[model samples]
Every structure is written in structure tokens, then in C-alpha cells.
Target: MDLLSIKDPRFLKDMNIEQLEKLSEEVRQFLIEKLSVTGGHIGPNLGVVELTIALHKVFTSPRDKIIWDVGHQSYVHKILTGRACEFDTLRQYKGLCGFPKRNESEHDVWETGHSSTSLSAAMGMAISRDLKNEKSYVLPVIGDGALTGGMALEALNHIGHEKKDMIVILNDNEMSIAPNVGALHNVLGQLRTAGKYNWVKDELEYLLKKIPAVGGKLASTAERVKDSLKYLFVSGMFFEELGFTYLGPVDGHNYEDLLENLHYAKKTSGPVLLHVITKKGKGYHPAESDKTGTWHGTGPYKIETGDFVKPKQAPPAWSSLVSETVRKLAREDDRIVAITPAMPVGSKLEGFASEFPDRMFDVGIAEQHATTVAAGIATQNMKPFLAIYSTFLQRAYDQVVHDICRQNLNVFIGIDRAGLVGADGETHQGVFDIAFLRHLPNLVLMMPKDENEGQHMVNTAVNYDDGPIALRFPRGNGYGVKMDEKLIQIPIGTWEVLKEGTDAVILTFGTTIPMCMEAAELLEKQGVSVRVVNARFIKPMDVEMLKSIFAEGLPILTVEEACLQGGFGSGVLEHAEEMGVYGHPIRRMGIPDRFIEHGNVDQLLEEIDLTSKAISEKITAMVPKKKQQRA
Candidate 1:
């Protein structure tokens, strides 16, 4: 069975059980080989092999609408939908997307990258199907971890109340990046203990009803006894109360179990929750043994030895620097506490959690809850450091504004991955955080030039008692600059000049600082002096420095690795307008309005024209003809 020849999922219906099992093995081998080089959500995809196959076999996709929640597990779904040949260029620039794309195939009815969106999307699709009187099943596959997300719960409540004709596949692998948290995980744990829900529970209930015999004497008490059995067998009366007919804690890897339950779900009325248990990284040795979430999403790895092909002796990651600094500070201050939205491994908070287990908290999948929880902690005069990814912070915009900023609490937000996060693409790029948070009142947003400065900024943010402060750091390792033995607090709204010049100025911070330095060097060769300024504080920008620079009447070029509209550069322009320097020669360089796609950082930067060469070119064009004409 050549998997590359697989055009669509239609052929699955004709295949026998043995053939289907063989096909599943082939698909698994295909993914293991393909992802060793391309590197994707292998753990997630590996976990859903039989489940995904059974889905295609049980439901008609294009018309029926099998929507994936997070879309990371859709790699197997992709292979069955005529995308096996595109594996070579997966997640590359202009290549096959890592997530489900509606334009890619007719089978991909709903596109998603973020978690906990499928239930809502499926609910809408199910309603639309009913309105048109179409006889097609709507299935949404979601993880037990994602089930903890507020949006998923909201959709669950809505779907149950509406009684939509849909099937919800609760893919319980006991993990979402890190092993799940919250009370919901405990409920799923109990549900897992309660075996096959459909048959035993139904049979026992039928027997209990038959105990009444010919007359209706003991009927009411028998009905109450039958109802009480729900808590004992299914343990998922949780879903039943919400109006969904709860099914089995079925074996997701077993073909017979999956097919049998899936077939039964189609005949059922209202929303049905099919709890399917799976083993993440079922076949792979290294990934299967993983508990720290190392295998969730990875770089290229050696298939034979399972060794990651990462750069050797690289600088410490920005996440480590920031988290370690906070951990160090937490030692002295009793009020300091840490929180993350189920990204303890990603944010390198293991050290903090180990040292002070009670102080550190990992709130699973609920960014909105995490943000407000930090605010609530801050109100008690406790320092809550909420470490979250920039892209994910979009989900908690209201909490950040209404709860944190509006109330003027002292919350330290560690905004990780604050720029274009290469491989994960537009759905993950952190370009919009500056735009979103810059406008919020009583919020101080800042970035750093190097790891040394990053630590100091983290210290400053923790110590600062005026309103909420956020420190933004890029995804990968730092510049490997010599770390300062003593950390100091940088004054609020202060900018540092890295290189001085008279003709023009280039203002940038964080990852773009090195680019600005190189751009200054490039301009120096052409006899154009360009001053490089680390405009670290984005919100309350260094006003005194701006005044002096404006007084000198130098041409200005604001560079950032973020969106141009309402970003750091926009703040500079607005300041210039207020300072009566609107007519001065001003230029802005940053990411344009369009969303950037997957690729390496260098390629994505070059594609967006955010390179040193682009900066040099922009600065050269800004100033008058002052070319040295190298002799």
C-alpha cells in the first residue's frame, strides 16, 4: 500500500479491518520518516493514527464536516486528504501549513491553529446544516486538555442546551503540551476509570426498569435507582447534565473499539461526547517515554537515536534568563509568585516550580483566567509574574485591559516569543502584542537589547510598584553577551544610546538591536552617521532623549520586528507630531499589514524587508546625498 498514492479518504470505506490496520502502520511510518527532517507535532499526530483513520471511515468528511480543534493533530488528517506528497516541504516558506487550511482540500471544512475553537465552529456548522435540512453528521475532535479552556466550556454549554446533532470526540491522552491541570483533569481521570459507558450502563438501566414486573407499583423508585447509577458507571453525568449523551472511554488505538463507538454515535440524537483514550507517541520510543513535553513540537531529530539536531553550545534561551531572574527574586521577596497558562516547560519555569512549588502555578489552557488570576493576586499586594506567549495573550485582551490595566494593579507580565516565531507561522507570530498593549492605559511595555539587559528589565519589572509592567522577549537564545553579576533596576521610560551619531538616528530594541548596529555600520561606510538607540520602553518613551534628538533636527528611522500600525514606531511618530516635529524627515520600518508565514527567522526577516541592509537603505534614503564615494 503506497501511501503517496492516497488521493482522498474515500478508499478507506472499501478496505477490510486487516488492510486498514496495515494502512495505519504505513501512515505511522510515513509520519515518523517525514517529520524526522521536517519536524512537526509528531507526538500529537502519532497519538491519533487509528482515531483519525476511523473518523474518515465512519463519517463523510467534505459534507459531514470533521473539524479538528487545535489542528496540530491534523497531520494524519492531511495525509488521508491527498497531502502525503507535500510532506517534503511541510512548514517551509510557502509550503504546506502545519495546521488545517480550508483552501488546501475540500475535506478541511474548518481552518484552525489555536486550541478550543473547533466546538464553537462545529456548533455553527451543525446549525447551518440543520437550517438547510442537510443530512450530514458534524464531528469536532478536541483534547481533554483543551476541554479546560473557557471557550470550549462555553461552547459545550451552548451545544448541550441547543441539542445540536453533532458528535464531540474527546481525545484524552492526558496531556496538552504539559500534563493537564485544573479540576476538569480530575473529572476526566474519574471518567477514564469508569469503563465502557454505552452498553453496561444502558443494560443495567434496562434491567432495573424490568424489575418493576407487571404492575407500576415500584416504578418511580426504580427510575430513581436507574438515574443514580449514572454517577457510578459513566461518571460523565457531567456531559449528560449538559444534555449530551455520553459514550465510552473507548480505546482510541484499537480499530474495533473506535469503529464500533463511532458508528453508534452517528445513530444517536443530540450532541454525543465519545471519550477516546490514546497513548501519545504510541510507537516512537523516545517520544513515548517523554513526560516533560519535550516531544510535543520539536526541531529536526535523529530517527535512529532520537537525538535532537540542535545547535551545540548555544547561548541560554531568553525564557531561561527571565524565569531564572524571577526565581532568584522570589527567594528574597515572600510576595513574589509565578503563573503560566500550561507552558511551564516552554517558559523554562521548572527551576522556579522546583524551588518554590507552592508559589509557582500552571493554569491549564485558560489565558483569560491566568491574566485575571494574576490581577487578583496583585490586589493583595502580592507580585504575580504571568509568563505567557505573545500570540496567546490575544485571547486575554479584555482581562489585561479591564482587570489589570484599568484597575492599575502591580502585575509583572513576561511576554515570551515577542516577535515572528518562525515555524508556527501567522497564528503564532507575536507581532501584534505591542499594538494591542501599547494603547492600554496604566501599562508599561518594554523590550531588551541583550540577555544582560533582559535580566535587569525583569528585575526592574518585579520591583516597580507603579501599575502593570510587561517585559517582552524573543523566542530563541540570546546574543550570549556577558551577563552582569549584579542586576540593577533600569529607570522607567529611559532609552540608552548604543552608538552616537550627528546626521540620523535608528531606534530599535530586543532582537532588532543587533540589526540596527549592523545597519549603523553599513551607513558609516557611506559617510552617513547613524545613531543606534535602544528604545527599550515602548509606552512611556524617553521624552528627554526625544527632545534632544528633535532639537538636533536629525532624520529619524524607527525600526521594529512588529506590525507598523500602532506599534513602537507609531508611538514615535505620534510623539514627533506632538513635539511639533511632524515636518521632520521621519521613516518607519517594520512588518507590513499582511500575516507572515512559516520559515526560518532570517528568511522571514528578508521576505519582510526587516534586514540590516533594508534598514541601511531606508536610512540612506532618509538623509540627503552624503555618500563618501569610496576612493
Candidate 2:
């Protein structure tokens, strides 16, 4: 059978282990070839090929819920669920999503992208099933790294306490984005090397039987000895103590082992934890050998040599610029420290970690903990720069509002990937940071127009001792702008006028600033002089500058690569209203109140009508014909 024609896993029900193994190989080859062109979570998908096959063979999907924790590893699940033929359009504009989409298939029971959510979602499904008097298994396949997340731990406590009949598959790959860290990771590590406990249990039971036929006290002592053996040999006893019927540290790649343990879990009553260990990036050589997590997710690469097809002479990545700047500042300032929520490589904090190992902390998959930790460090008069992606920051909203903003601590938040992140889609886009952060009092939120300004913003955030300051930088490479020899701190709430004109004023910042500039230049060709202002500061906005711009009575067009509601544009409107400045035709251009899907940055921007041509046309219409003639 053709791999592409494999619409569903119903075909696997009759196939033996040998046939399943062959199918797994075909699936892996398909993923490697498909993902090499489209680019995706290749490492995770590759690792789970066999495990996924085993799972589909045992359990019925759509009926028995299989919730993937982060959903990045759901590629194999997708392939088996009739999405194999749609691989060509994967992550492309208006095509198949990278993450699990509820609308995509009936098999995708729960949508996920952020880590540690599967347990809670599975619990909900279990409860719903129970309330409806339905009989179906609810299994959440969670990674070892994601197990450290506070929410996952919370869910574990609840699920154990509730004693619901559900199977929790702990996918112990020993990694999240980077290698797993902290105490929980250590616990899983101990479990991985503990070997099979069933053999030891059988041996102990036989030895205890040999000493039987001795009455009461002797029988009690034998029972105690059996219990003691569990503590000595079974690492899964930890989960047993949590009120869960713990299974094995099963070999995730072995079909026989997976099937056996899965069968055992099905037979067991109440909550059961099935621990399965597998290697991340299993089959592909480049991905398999990856120690630094570079191959976890990647772009187009050569299939033969396993080398990434490099684009011609790109500018410095935004992450590298911000993180490297932080590292540079940390050299002089002893108080400066860096923290990331499991993304050292993605955040480009590897240099900082290398330079200041003691000062850098990677609090694996715990965004809420990371935010508060930064706050705790700030209380001691030490500066902690919490580098986090914009989407993940949404998880730490309460911590930011209550701990950091309310306390007015001097914590520098480096908001990496601050706008449409492309390929990763709606779940990963950083569009909400501006709207979310701006609303919090005492939190200074800003973005830079270019990498040079980004360095200064980093300096500003570090230097600002008033309250919590956040610097948002977009994903991908910078504009290849010239750098300054000396770092200078720009004043808070200050706007820079990039190009001056009298017809209309274009207020924008960060990635949108380039678009505004280009639009302004194009408008100049059309005999319409447009002023472009870099409204970098989103919160505590440049009020004085805004007042001056409105005083000129020039039609104002505010643009941002963020949501229109409660965003930079809305901020401008609120200020205009507060100052009693009315009758000035103000137009706002930004992301609409809808989730933008996965695609390239250019495609996404164009889809949202955020291109230079769109901006120029809007600005031309906004400016009066009389004003155009004067210019």
C-alpha cells in the first residue's frame, strides 16, 4: 500500500508487529522527506513514529481521546488520521496547520501548542465522559520536560486525587525544546535506568512463596518484605504513592513492549501512568545526533548531507541581537542575570549562559514560575531579565500583574518573537503581547524599529529602575542596519520622527515601521507628503509627541503588527480622547480581532492588508486632496 494512501490506522488493527515495524519505517521516511521541504517539528515526529503506530493499534482514536501535550509531535498522529495527502501544503498560508487544529480532523480531539496542557485537557475529557456515562479511554501523552510545568503537576495531583479511569502516557524523551532540567527531570532519569521492575517483582514473589506455610507473623513479615522490594526496585512506586496504578518504564520504540504495557493499563482500574522512554530525533542521523536541540525544528535541509540550506547573507537574528546585548551588559553589571522558560537556544541565550552560567537560569516549561522568579530576584535589588516568547508570556499574565507590576519591581522582560511568528501558526504568533502587557500598570512596554535601536532598548530596559520594563523584538533577521559604537539609553515614552511631512502622520513601531517608511516614500511619489514616526513605546506612550502631532491637525494613521483592540492603535485613540482632541480623522491599521494562521511573514502581512501598497493607499485616502496639493 502507498504511504500517502494510508488514510487511517484501521488498517493497523489486523497487521502483526512485523508489518507495523515496516509501516513505522515508511512513516519516518515520509516525514523526513516531507518536513525537509516544508519544515516542521521533525525531531519530535521522527521519535514518536513507532510509539504512535503502537498506540493506534491498541486504542481507537476519536472515541478514545489521545491528547498530545505540545502537539508538535502529532505529525505521526496526523499522518495516520488521513492528513498524509495534505503534507505538501503543511504550514503554508491557508493550508494544513503545524499544530493540532480541532477543525482539521475528528481524530485531533484537543488542540495544543503550548506545553503541559494535555493532562488538564484529558482530565476535562474524562470528567465529561463520566458525566455523560460514556465508556472511552482518555490518554494524555505528555513529555518528561513538560511534566515539570506547574500546571501539569497541578493536574497530576487532581487526577490522582479524583482517581479517574484514565491512562497517562509519560513520553520520557528527556527533552522539551532544550534538554530537560530540575528535580522532576532527575526523577525521570532515575526511572529510565531502573530497568524492568516486573522481573524483580516475580523473583521476590517466588522467594516469599518459598518461605510460606509459616503462620501469622511470618506471613506479615513476608508481605512487608514484598512491599519493601517495591521501594527498592520499582521507580514507578513514586506514581503509585500518588494514588495512580503505575505501569512501566517501557521501551517506547519496541512494539511488543508498548502493546503489552498498554494492554495492562487498559485492564487496570482508576488512573494509570504508563511510562515510555524513547530517543528524540530517533531515526534521522542529523536529528538523532542533535545535542543542542538545533534539529528539534528546522527549515529546508539537504536530505543527503543533512545540512540546512542556508539563505544568502541574512542579517543578525532579532533573538541574537537582544540576547547578545544582554550578555554584553551582564559583563559589566554583576546584578544582571538572564532567565528563560526552557528556551536557551531559541531565545539565543546560549552565549549568556556560557558567559555567565551562574547568572543564567532555564526554568523548564514553567512560565508562571519564571516570571515570579524574576520578581523575587528584583526584590533583592538584583536585575533579572526574563527572556520569553510573546505567546508563552500569556501564561504568566497573573504573575506579571500581581507580582511584578503591582510590586513595581525592576525586572527587564525580553519579549522575543513579538509578532506574527509564521510557520508555527496561531498558537505561536506573538501578536497579543502588546495588548496584554500595555494594560498592566507600571509595566513599561516598548519595541524597537531596528536591531541598532533594539540594542538601545535593551540598555533602556536594563537601566530603567522605576518598574517592570519589557522590550519586544519580532522574529527572524533584523534589517541589517548599522550599529552604534556606544550603547545609549533612550528616554521612556519618547517617539522618534523618522521622516517629517505635513500631509499625514504615520505612527508605527518595530516590524511595521519599515512598512510605514516604505509607504511614506511611495506616498511622496504620489505628491502626498507623509510623516513617519516610530512610536516605539506602547505603554506610557509618548504623550507630549502625540499631543504635538494632533495639534498640527494632520490625519493620524497608527499601524502595528499586533491586535487592533487594546493595542498600540487603541492606546493612541484613548490618549486622543483623554486630551479632548476630536474631529481629527484617525485611522488605525493592524491585525484584526482574529487569529492569524501560519505562513511566511510576507504572506501573513499581505493577507492582513499590512503591506506598503495597502498602507500607502490608506494614507492617500486619509489625507485630504487640499493637503495633498499643498505638499
Candidate 3:
């Protein structure tokens, strides 16, 4: 149980099933205790204890690559590979990443936070190994939910066609954050439950092989017979048809079965698919029963009762406001539908799903599918609101351009977490949405200044039947601003001046607006009058407002909780030039062109000079220097 003494030579090679099981329990207990304080992906780690052990025993890591799909389930893998002591720092700044990071450990071959990437990465690794004549195995552990993604399917098709020597362990626990959906899940379920047929078929083959003279010759034909029997009995010929030698439905928790199947998979020459079923929360009681995704990614909790150590006074989440507004709108109109790509709970669409079961859809980590499907629904005269995290939406950029924007479909994209989503870090930051979404034609992109504006935008997007519209909102709580009972649809492509000043104009949108407002008040007290404008719509820039500011010959400052490059500021710069306004000094304030690290959101903002005090001081310094130059 003392994992630090894993310097013991026999840790992997000599451990029996009993010893391994005990170690698994120890690992689970350790994870629970540590995660209870730190708060991380406790459910996923608790599920894969035996499987990680089996994998290490069967294949030499750092040589034989193992790509963990999504990588949240790699906590057990991390523990076994000499990171047990650092588990307490999970998800903290400069600490262990919640997901598998290649930089953190040699055992982690590919870094991943997004889903359905493991197979493709594994295939590339396998082909490269073959090319280099390096005789090492390439194994990718993917889940049933990830399999639902189109990219995973595309990889499967390619891997099947190539018939490369690789092992894909399909971890089927009937869930990925939520209960697994679609026909593929049902097909896998049928295969996993075909034990009766397997038993009978194995007995018959044993009997056939026992006869003396014909036994040797018949053994050759027996494989074909076995394949046929599998097709007749089990429905998992779906994997075999993809050129993989299917091997499981084996108990992922059982050490002997897992090790045996893994050994078998390692020895196979062509593509192999081992189906291992595991519970999402194998050891923890409350997590085991969690059908919702509460335990998927969580904060610190009480280990004994599995109760989250919720903040004493929690803030009203923006996602909840989006969901509540959308639900109310849908209740009023049958044509309004809600869609998400495997993030119903994260986006707070569970309430909508409950009220309008058929209308609410979870496309299962298939961002591309969700986007196109929403486009398709829009074509049929239905308003499909896609509520997806900004980072995940990056996976469907092509679809947004080709399927929706090209056709000018009226789809409402509720872009949640469209800013610096701290703690989750680079792979999960929502800062690139404005840059990417702005370039697409026939697409309207905007961010709300507060929950009231978010709700208003939702209403505006619902009524407008022109082109694809997107409304982005940041993570966590609203600004606690009271909502308007009646939806006030502001004119599209107009900016509202919150505070009128003469020195310089600060144009901002989304989360940065409040910060700008704070800066404005500070500047007013300092005798440097500043103009504050909430440029709600990123696209279709308010020309009148820009013209007014140019007429005053005031310095312009643009701020957003998005990327600095080609974002709202770029739009302002481009417009200023187009309007023939010369030598207007402009300062663009936002996330720099670099990957942000994990930390608390407020700390990260301060680090990036996005805090109110930082912005106020910067503006004060800039204006005074400009006035001196004029003098």
C-alpha cells in the first residue's frame, strides 16, 4: 500500500490478484481522501484503478504508449507512475493537472482535455512506431461516450482500413459525464450482455476440438466458426468489421480478467479492440449512483457522505440564467429547442430537458454533429439554441462556417464560458471564440454585459430570423443585476454609452464591461473624464458610436475577456481606419497571444492586467502622457 516504495522490483511483475485488488482499494481510498480536500475528477479516477494496474503490467509505459481518452480518468495512472504524493495539489496553480499532461509525467504519452482524440493520436503513434521500426505497443483507452463522437468514428474507420498493429481498450461504463446515448451505446450494451451465447459457443468449440483425428484440421476452421458464432450471438461485429480483433466485455475491476485480456491484446498483430466495462465511480458510494455529471468535475467535498463543500453563499451562475431564459422561451414557443454536446449539466440545461424532454438534446461529445444538427433543425423552421462551452465549440468551427454560416441558418449559439475559464487552464480557456467566430460571414457574434443583457440577447436571437446568431457569456455568476420582466430588444449593431466623458472612450463587452465601469468611476474621481460604452455586438460594429468618438478626437481603448488578436479591438481598429479617422491612438486590452495557465479566475485576470484597478491605473497613465505630448 506504500506507493512511494514502488521502487520494489516486484510491484508490477509479482503482484497476485489479491495484492493487486488491495492496492486498487488503497489507491481509491487515497484518491478519495486527497480529492476531498483538493476537489477534482474523483469519480473517473475511482473507476479505473484495476485497469491502470493491468495496463502497466501488460505494457512498458514510456516505451509502449498509452493515450488516455479525455485524460480525466488518468488519476489512477498518475498515482501508479510515481505521482501519488502530489495528488493533493490537483487542479491548483503550479500543481498537478486535473487532466493528463504529457509535461507532468512520462507515463502520459498524449495530453488531452477534449474528448475523442485518443484514437487518432494513438493511430499516429502506432504508424510512426512502425515506420521507425520500433517494436512497441500503442494502446488507447477510450470510453463508450467518446466513441459517440464523429472524430472517434472517423479514426476507427481509418484504423480499420489501415489494419495497423494497435490496441484500443473501449472502457464502457454506459456513461461519459452523463448516461451514454445513441444506437452505438445500445449495440455495445447488447454485446456486453451476450455472455450466455459466449458460454454455449465456447463449450461447443471445446467439444469439437476434443475429437482426435479431425481436431488438428478443424482447429484452423474453428476461428472462422467462432467469428460466425460471434456475429450470430453478439452484436459487436461492428468493431470486427472495422478490422479490430474484438476481445472483451471483460470486468475492468477484475485483475485477472483485465491482465489476461490486456496480455492477449498486446500479443495480437493487427488492430485489436478490448471492451472493458467499468463504473464511473467504482469505489465511492455516492459517485457510483451519480447519473448526473456532478461528480465528473467537482470542488472539494466530504469524502464520507460525498457531499460537496459548497460555498456558504454561492453566486448565481450565468449558465443557469441562460438555461432559465431559454426554458421560459421554449415554454412559450414549441419551435425553440435546446441542444448541447455532452454538457447538459455544465451548461445547466437539465431543467430544460426535464420540462421538454423531446426538445432538449445531448449529442454526446460530438460537437460537429451538434452544430450541423442544429443547422439542420433551423432549416426546418425550428430555432435550435446550441448551449456549448466555448472551448468545445472550437471542435465544430468547420461546421459553423460550412453548414450554418454558408447557408445562413438561424441557429442560436449560447456560447458559455467565453473568456478566461481559470483552473482548467490552456486547453479549456474560452478566449478564442471571439477571434474565430468574428471571421465567419453571415454570423452575428455578441457577448452580454450582464445576465439581463444575456436574457435580452436570447430573446433577440429567438425573434430574429436572419442568419446564425451567437451570444457568449462568461463562466460563474451573473453581476447580480435585476432582470427586466419584458424583453427589451435593442437595435442590432448599436453600442450603448454607459457613461459619457470627453478625455478617452473605453469600449468593452461581456465580463470586461463591469471592470471598465469600475475603471470609469475611478478616472472620474481622478479628474480624467472617461467615456464607457458596452459594445454588445462584436460583429456589425456600431459605426455611429465610432464616428462620435472620432469626432471628439479622443483616444480609444477596447477591452474584452477574449483574445487580443483579431478580436473586438481589431474590429474597432479596422473600422476606425475604414472611416478615414487618422492617428487615433488605440489600446487593446485582453488575453495576450499565449496559453494561460491554471489558477483562480480573479488571480488570472490580475496577472493579465484585466482587473478593474489595473485597467484604471493603465488608463490614467496613458491619458496623462498623451496630454503632456499635446502640450
Q: What ranking emerges by TM-score with the best candidate at the front? A: 1, 2, 3
TM-score of 1: 0.98
True lDDT of residue 397, candidate 3:
95
* Model 2 Cα lDDT, one tens digit per residue, 455-563: 9999999999999999999889998999998999999999899999988999999988878899999999888988999988888899999989889899999999999
lDDT of 3 by residue, 1-631 (tens): 7875553223677778888888888988888888899888878888888898888877888788889999889888887788877876777777888888879877878988999999999999988998999999899999999999998999999999999999999998888888778889899989888764535676878876675656666677776776688778786579878888788679989887888778867777899999988988888888888989788878889987888897666657999998889899888899999999988999999899999999999988899999999999999999999999999999999999999999999999999988988778888999999899898999988888888888898898888799999989988888678889998776788889889988888999888888899999887777788889999989988988789888888888888888899999999999988999778778889998898888788888878888888788778766856553442
Separate clash counts for every candidate:
0, 0, 0
| RMSD in order of candidates | 1.4, 1.5, 2.5
Q: What TM-score, computed on C-alpha atoms, does each candidate reach?
A: 0.98, 0.97, 0.95
Pairs of colliding residues, candidate 1: none
Misplaced by over 4 Å in model 2 are 202-216, 629-631
Q: What is the lDDT of candidate 3?
A: 0.86
